[model samples]
Target: MEPDTLFVVGLALGVLSIPAVVSSVSRGERPRIATITLMIAGTMLVWAISNKPGGYSIEAIPAMVKRVLQGFT
Candidate 1:
């Protein structure tokens, strides 16, 4: 898979985990899976950023996401 894809997936996972963690806390349960998901997301983001040359810029993420999505359809 492409680094852009990894970055997009990581970003999505990170965003999704937020709600899961919040719900878990509200229910007085451990955020076990949610915490793990967040950790994996962070790792993916770091790996993707490191693998890309010169690293990614904040401005470049939207275009990167667009390109990755285009590949799926």
Candidate 2:
């Protein structure tokens, strides 16, 4: 997959995991799954950023997300 796509996926996964982490904590659980999800997401995002030419910029994210979504439809 493209670096931008990977970055967007990882970012989305990381964002989604926040609710899981919060729910687990509220329920007095260990949040194991959420923790793992966060770790993997972080790894993917970091890898994508490091591998991409010129690095990543916040300004390019919307276009990147649009391009990725277009591929799936």
Candidate 3:
């Protein structure tokens, strides 16, 4: 898929998931830490998706890969 297409897909999914996030937190159905983490992650994903930096761009890939590697080590 194209960058724009992927971005739209990510943005749509992120926005659509917002309601579930609220419901999950409100009902105390999931752990607080997990819910909070999801919100934070979703927020970042939404920003990346909506902005013009573009999906999976060269600049983004390095930073993202760095973060992932850092997380595991």
**Could you say which candidate leads in lDDT?**
1
**TM-score for each model:** 0.94, 0.93, 0.44
Best by TM-score: 1
Report how far off residue 57 is in candidate 2 (Å): 0.9
lDDT of 3 at 59: 66
What stretches of model 1 exceed 4 Å from their correct place?
A: none
- TM-score between candidate 1 and the true structure: 0.94
Tens digits of per-residue lDDT, candidate 2, 1-73, equal 7888889899999999999999999999999999999999999999999999999788888888888889889
lDDT of 3 by residue, 1-73 (tens): 3334344445455566677778877897864555555566566666656664534665665565555546557
User: 1-73 in candidate 1: lDDT tens per residue?
Assistant: 6788999999999999999999999999999999999999999999999998898999988999999989989
Clashes of 3: 0
Candidate 3 segments exceeding 4 Å error: 31-73
Ranking by lDDT: 1, 2, 3
Once fitted onto the true fold, the runs of candidate 2 whose alpha carbons sit more than 4 angstroms away are none
Taking all chains together, the TM-score of candidate 2 against the true structure is 0.93
